[model samples]
Target: MLNPIDLHYEWFGVLWLEEENHFPIIVGYWFSKERSEITQDAILSGFSTWTEIGDHSMIMRMYQSIRNKQKKQDWEKRTRLSLRTIFNSPWNEVSPGLYLIKSRDTYPLHVSAILKKKFWVWLEHTAVCETKEELQAFMQRVHEEHQMEISMKNTKPKFL
Candidate 1:
């Protein structure tokens, strides 16, 4: 039986195979932040993958296969997101105060530049605020400084 601490967060959303109880497959999503109940039935309701462990030698093979597949899928998703961003926005410029952070490829340099001038420099990366107030302030600064209208499309990622 694998300890609960042994599991990783990336696999939290998916089902896991348990080696104990004759390789009984269990489906659950682990909430890492909370540590109250060790075994809760509510958290174990989901779909199950394969859970079959033969001997000690076969355990390694099953573990490796699951880990490899998860990593590959994660990498593919990131690559797709990156490509989408690049296709959407081919040109990007570095602003003076704020670093250009790419989220879905459209580099809102003008908006970011305005934020740097209006807000404290420390707030640039210290927090990724998704509230309406922060985004409105950022857009307002951009419009006032550069006379450019920030569109909703550019600010969707900041909130979502």
Candidate 2:
């Protein structure tokens, strides 16, 4: 099993790789205000405690500074929608098995994978992208290449 700390760092790295100057905002709308308040309090207290610890003060400071700076940036101030909202919006119903790749300097590219009826399968390989356009083009090229390879494999030589 993956440790929570490892997962958190991995997610942070991924977001940083995708957005040069921003961190993702994880939001959850709970039916219970008590739970929400409790969670927020815990986070704020945790931040405060970490700030006091001084061991990782530099990292905390850097993250806080970046958060403040991002809040001031025009693009950062805009309301960001969650992937669930984007994919399951009332206006459209996106098919499952779709994934998105985002880069620090580009838009998000949507990609799909083959899957069994309701089971999720992991990709044998991962895709890399430095930009949104690059990501989309990469996916397209990959699909085309795979198709050509499959065609060649399927075609048998004619015998006399």
Candidate 3:
């Protein structure tokens, strides 16, 4: 019997990590009302609670997570849509099982990237701007949200 590590977050419930494994075996329900997406790595590392993972970084995680969800044959058999098709971009496979998809064109308020673990997976994260100013504003909002979450998690019932 393995003891679950309960991370006190609204979305995340009990996290189960194997004693021998460095990676998490089971990371509880991942849900977020915030527009920004957090990654499993960040969740396991507790970085998600304090810092925002960049869109590019999230994209990599999304790709890897989706690939890990099922065997290649099983995944291909299940859907006609490739990951590239789902991403709606001509993603370059920089290395084996690694992808790179970025646009040089800049558009204000434009949705730059959309990432998800799988097609049916409701959890998705997106990058929403093409400019430094927009990115800064977005990060600011994320920082504020993280701070609020931390404060709420730290709040306890004062039994007088």
Candidate 4:
């Protein structure tokens, strides 16, 4: 789970950071999600686009900012929090140099459509896979799963 302290806050928006090779930097407002879906769709969508380009010159990460639920304007008090949820979450090395991370802290609770309460989520990915064989195995499993889903969708139900 995310830090227990996060329960007191809600997501404010997303912060996108880009690491450029050169010292020069360019920043812009990307997108924001307010009381929106808490799923990792936003992160994965951006990551997919990043992978397609195969851009080694730049690296990108998304951070979600949190704001206190209580209303109080105290200049001395800290009320805002931002964390790299995806990267900071726990990861297990499935294979050598191959890491796997789940998207939620607790399975059923975090999988709900609209969160009634706060829960932790981490973006899943293979942190590192040195060989095409390992990557291929992952891709092949996905393909097989997709095929099964399609087959199930096309099947006619045998009503009694």
* Cα lDDT computed for each candidate against the true fold: 0.34, 0.30, 0.32, 0.26
Which scores better on TM-score, 1 or 2? 1
Clashes of 3: 0
- lDDT of candidate 3 vs native? 0.32
- In Å, residue 140's CA in model 4 sits off its true spot by 0.4
Q: Evaluate model 3: give its TM-score.
A: 0.20
Q: In what order do the candidates fall by TM-score, top score first?
A: 1, 2, 3, 4
Residue lDDT tens for model 4, 14-129? 33444766442322222323434422445545532322222323322222122121111111232211233322322111111212222233321111011011332322222122
Specify the highest-lDDT model's number: 1
Query: CA RMSD for every model?
Result: 15.4, 17.5, 19.8, 19.6
Best by TM-score: 1
Clashing pairs in 1: 85-105
Error of 3 at 103 (Å): 6.1
Per-candidate TM-scores read 0.25, 0.22, 0.20, 0.15
Question: What is candidate 2's lDDT per residue for 63-118, written digit by digit as tens?
Answer: 55553453234212223233334333321332333232222232322222221112
TM-score of candidate 1 relative to the true fold: 0.25
Residue-wise lDDT of candidate 3 within 1-160, one digit each (tens)? 0011221223322233345656534543343333333255446657445333345654345434543452233212322334444343222211112111223233433211112234321111123343668555644543453332211111121110
